[model samples]
Target: MRSVNYARPTPALAIHDLRKSYGDLHALKGVTFGLNRGERLAFLGPNGAGKTTLIRCLAGLTSADHGEIFLAGQPFKSSEARQQIGFVPQEIALYADLTTRQNLEAFGRFHGLRRRVLRDRLAWALRWTGLEDRADDLVGAFSGGMQRRVNLACGVMHEPRILLLDEPTVGVDPQSRQRIFMMLDELSATGTSILLTTHHLDEAEERSDRIVILDQGMVVADGSLDELVEQSVGTQRLVRLRIDRPLSAPIRAGVAEHAASFGATGEEEISTRIDDVSDHLPGLIDLVRRRGYGIADVQVEAPSLHHVFLHLTGYELRD
Candidate 1:
């Protein structure tokens, strides 16, 4: 298998000036981004931020008013080009009445796989979903998580070069959500490019190689976590120290001239923002100790994806 995180000569999927509209309401406005080969990208947006619309446009489900899409360095046109992309919608698109094996068989055949290849992949899908023991069980009888796994297996049966997942773990429990990501990890290890949308910020923050945040149908932020933080939210860390008593006159004078603004929130609370913890925290501690002040506790909060998202978009990702 090709190494999962290696750089490629070109992006697996490239979208430029992708725009769509419904009457006067614009669903997408000049959206543009690229999905690097073998990289997992989080496409995030709030409700009605055009994430779903962009996905639909790329999947060829909904026509965009204007845009250019490229797959593997060529203009993305024709059914053959479409064949290189696999999309899993947020809804569980499966026949619940059908048995797990039956569903797999149907999906494989729909993908135009021959009997022998379909048969081999059927077993692989069943095993990959960890539903081999329940192969004959009806998908409707399975839990939401189980049904989701089957849904995922059906979409990827053809092993498309690019995978677009919409809310892959939306309705599932935590354990199943974890399992779903592990399954995606296996796919990524085989060098599949992934672009997934989810309401879960923590998952996006933790799982994605890069983040592209959309707001009001526009690409608002795009970069790694640290890059986003530095670009959108400054890198200063908030430090709050709870001491036993107020600072002495001498200690207050010593720290008053510092750029971090060592100020007392209360008789026992010292609050400041520091650029470097190792260089600043110990000095503050020693300064307090030398003055015979007792330390109670300390808290340091660095900027996170949550902070960057809020700063850039100015709205919590509701829905």
Candidate 2:
């Protein structure tokens, strides 16, 4: 008799062969990925890249045409999986006339949290959002940032196992954005999985554990910043040097020999595009200095996430 092998426990979320369509349009084309427990994954892409469709399917608001999603080892279509997921949309959903405490209590009850559990969750939600002092005040009376915080607190009131956030930091002050991320960090520390979609590249690059880039319903790139940069942009770095005075024609020719390409930007500034600035910069600077010019300024710009995005997806604006 053959021995039986049980499957390993699934991660917080596993999406396989996700496909969705609208008439002639294929929104998601066999999308597949897995998110680890306590991981923060940022989903990014150009407009109309199926981000909304994917989120809808994950949140259980819309059924996928063909796919399978498992949450914490349970089929995503099951009630158990649905109960463990929390969603925070771009638009605020709290009742304006209700107080912060009232909103949380209503959400907690709707999630079937009862008695002491509801009370404890509500108190923690208020304290986590720094809304304990304003618990009795109407949500409409709060600032945009405060209201955003309330909106977040409501989604988290049930202590969900996984959270999906869509542009949670949109239209808020920097301080509020910081608080929102801090709150998310705390949740992640407690072992909650997070999936985020936002247009803020810097925020995604800074906060996410891993990033997945979708373009026209396909996974074009997936990895950390260093990994993506190495694959897409190579080891190149942009170096700009300005001198007190422009070099003579012969001296300019000498600088060009050491650079992949050198061009005059301003009166005394020259731009050098090179791979591994550390190797070429010293030589280039010495070459320029020997020609009787003082180095006025030096600027080194690295390839960034934005550059990688534009590289994979063109610079044309998407509606």
Candidate 3:
């Protein structure tokens, strides 16, 4: 029998041939990926797509039956590996009776920080998370968003090299979400590699350096935003045109012929996906004029990450 060798660390986080199963259900099917130093990547998928399972395996909260995980160029099973990574779980992990400062102090000490260092780290983390003014307030009295911020502060107080965040903005308000994004942006600037899992498509598009879309324990797509869109949806652009007069049958047929796909709203507006806008727009205008109709407005919409997900998986991400 050939024994599995698991000592290696090439990237900030690397998993090869990772497999995990729970009795009859397969939670992860050989999931593999690499995150480089200072990279911000988003893990995107519907519920039950194994995103949480993968995170647990990396965090050592669960053991993989087969496969290997490496952190910072070393086996992830080691204590050194665990110390190098910080995880903010989907659930709020904090002591309700503890103050914000106390929470950080407790977690910092768990990582074996000295008392003096722990205090300094607690102060800095409170300031960094914008909880300096509320440091003495019991967590039980804090708002949901404030608690979420403190949860993250506790995980990151020691300045770990990599951060794994699982739906950190699930229930937060818009302002709190914005604040968290701003903080993550600052962390990225300081060269902290971050792997976040979220269902917020717009937020992921704006924040992640790369997006990995998973479905049914498989990676359906992975790349930068533009690359994934272009790979999945081709070159067609969505266009919506509003006309002064209702579309005649012949004009509608003409529009369909010029567009790869199109739909009409009785007669006032037409939405279409076309290959070449410059080539198709003039022809569309000419057709409207010939049909005794006038063009009132035209709008073009690019394919978003949502559309790309649908195109690749044939189902909405939420479904």
How do the residues 1-319 of candidate 1 rate in per-residue lDDT, one tens digit apiece? 1224436677898999988999998999999888888789999988889999999888888888998989988888747655788889999999999999999899888878878889999999998999999999999999999999999999888888899999999889999999999999888878788999987999998888889999999999988888898998889998887888775543453444542435543467777777999998898887777667788999999998888888887865545
Query: What are the TM-scores, per candidate, against the unseen true structure?
Result: 0.90, 0.90, 0.89
The lDDT of each candidate is: 0.86, 0.84, 0.82
Ranking by lDDT: 1, 2, 3
Residue-wise C-alpha lDDT for candidate 3, range 201-290, written one tens digit per residue: 988888888889887777888778888988988768887778886655534543445533234435688777778889987876676666
Output the better candidate (1/3) by lDDT: 1
User: Which of the predicted structures, 1 or 3, would earn the higher TM-score when compared with the native?
Assistant: 1
Please state the error at residue 216 of candidate 3 in Å: 0.9
Instruction: Kindly state the number of residue pairs that clash in model 1.
Output: 0
Q: After superposition, how far is residue 159 of candidate 1 from its true place, in Å?
A: 0.4
Error of 1 at 75 (Å): 1.3
lDDT, model 2: 0.84
- TM-score ranking from best candidate downward: 1, 2, 3
- Write out the backbone clash pairs for model 3: 9-73, 9-74
